[model samples]
Target: MDIQEKARPPAEVYDAQFVPALFAQWGQVVCAEASVREGDRILDVACGTGALTLAAADIAGPSGSVVGLDVNPEMLAVARRKPAQIEWLEGAAEALPFPDNSFDAVVSQFGFMFFEDKPKALAEMMRVLKPKGGLAVAVCDAVENSPGYGAFALLLDRLFGKEAGNAFRAPFSLGEAGQLTAICREAGLSHAEVVRRNGKVRFKSIDALVSTERACAWTLGGVLNDEQFERLLNESLSVLEPFTVDSGAVEFGMASLIIKARKV
Candidate 1:
């Protein structure tokens, strides 16, 4: 598999089973911060498979409207197969296709990492929010904060060695709380709160983990050519062989960051 094409595994893997569960996991926290009320319009940026969009629909009720936006057609296809209660639009976070101050709230789950330009995306998120509207973007902290990922990453490094394995950069400025605060401030967000949600999702086995790696292609960023990709894949699989038990079912937990703010 071309690793760069599928770098964000969480988006693709969770497009099925995990997306809804992740929504259910953070539903209340997001709703509480979003301050959703009847008749309020909401926007879910990079809505992925529409988990947060559906969650926003639940909170917005029939009176409020929820618009889900995503740039990935494959992911959007999975989202479209769901019920048609939500308005799913094709768009990018860096350039939202909505009027200024159009939404009472804007929410994104685990999407900031994929953004090529975070400040530009944040500014767009701010622009879409109505005056005083809330914005909540959830992202996972560094691998160190997430135990399952740390172990998974360690295994990758051991198998691929430091040179080839360090392709994973946690993808965002998540480890720097101060940096996040400053970004929010620059984006014209006020009353911001950086909350840590220490949570974990258990995989049935190591094969499941491998499946996730294959589908998402986390580490091989363009640096790994076809030969290196095959070698790394074989080496990683060999390393994971011992961890496979009871048909390769294993449990792994993740710690995530839930940053909430209000557009000034």
Candidate 2:
């Protein structure tokens, strides 16, 4: 399957497995960093299953308006089940459907890296924000900096191929702070600041981590046969043993870069 197809997982799996494990904390951080106010109009671009969108809606309150836009209909379908107060729209980040200067804040959590046209997406985000409005984005750092994901990618490469491994690496492709800042500037969002922070990646167990990856992670589900998946589970448990804590949960350090900017 193509990368796009691989990236699309069952909405149920995404909401149940991926969101709580990873995206939820980043959602809170991104919305807070973006300064989503009680009555501010907010836009969440590439909002996968509304992790950030829901957070923004809660922060924006009833007086404020929040819209969650994504190119994936399945993702939007999942998000639509959330608070009716938040408008969930289907659209691409490269060409947002909204009019210019329509939002007080635009925030994306772990979504900017997947846009096919980074510059155009940045431009659209800039175009939608009110003057001096904030934009915040969080993206994963290098795979090397995330030991769990690094090991996962290496195992995928060994088991599948480089193509399969690329799915894991793609999210971290734009991890560099300089690259992120340059993109914002190139898209006319000058004065962008990129901050790197360390975060913890935790899972109840090695099996839980592998199951979540197979269910929600890109290019993982449907690629491995039953036997292969079992082997992978065993291998992952072995690989993650060093990171297992006293409670038998796997916890590892992962770094992320949060890019903050404002329209001039």
Candidate closest to the true structure, highest TM-score: 2
| Candidate 1 residue runs with Cα over 4 Å from true position | 1-13, 17-24, 168-173, 217-248
Per-residue error for 243 in candidate 1, Å, reads 9.8
Runs with alpha carbons beyond 4 Å of true place in candidate 2: 1-9
Candidate 2, lDDT over the whole model = 0.82
The digit string of per-residue lDDT tens for model 1 on 176-228 reads: 57767777776665567888776555556544444444555434344555565
Q: After superposition on all CA atoms, what RMSD does each candidate show versus the true structure?
A: 4.3, 3.7
TM-score of each: 0.80, 0.90
Clashing pairs in model 1, backbone N/Cα/C closer than 3 A: 200-253, 200-254, 204-249, 204-250, 205-248, 205-249, 205-250, 206-248
- Tens digits of per-residue lDDT, candidate 2, 73-186, equal 988888888756888889999989989999999999888888888878988888999998988988998888898888888988997788767866887898788898888878
- Find the 10 residues in a row with the least total lDDT in model 1: 1-10
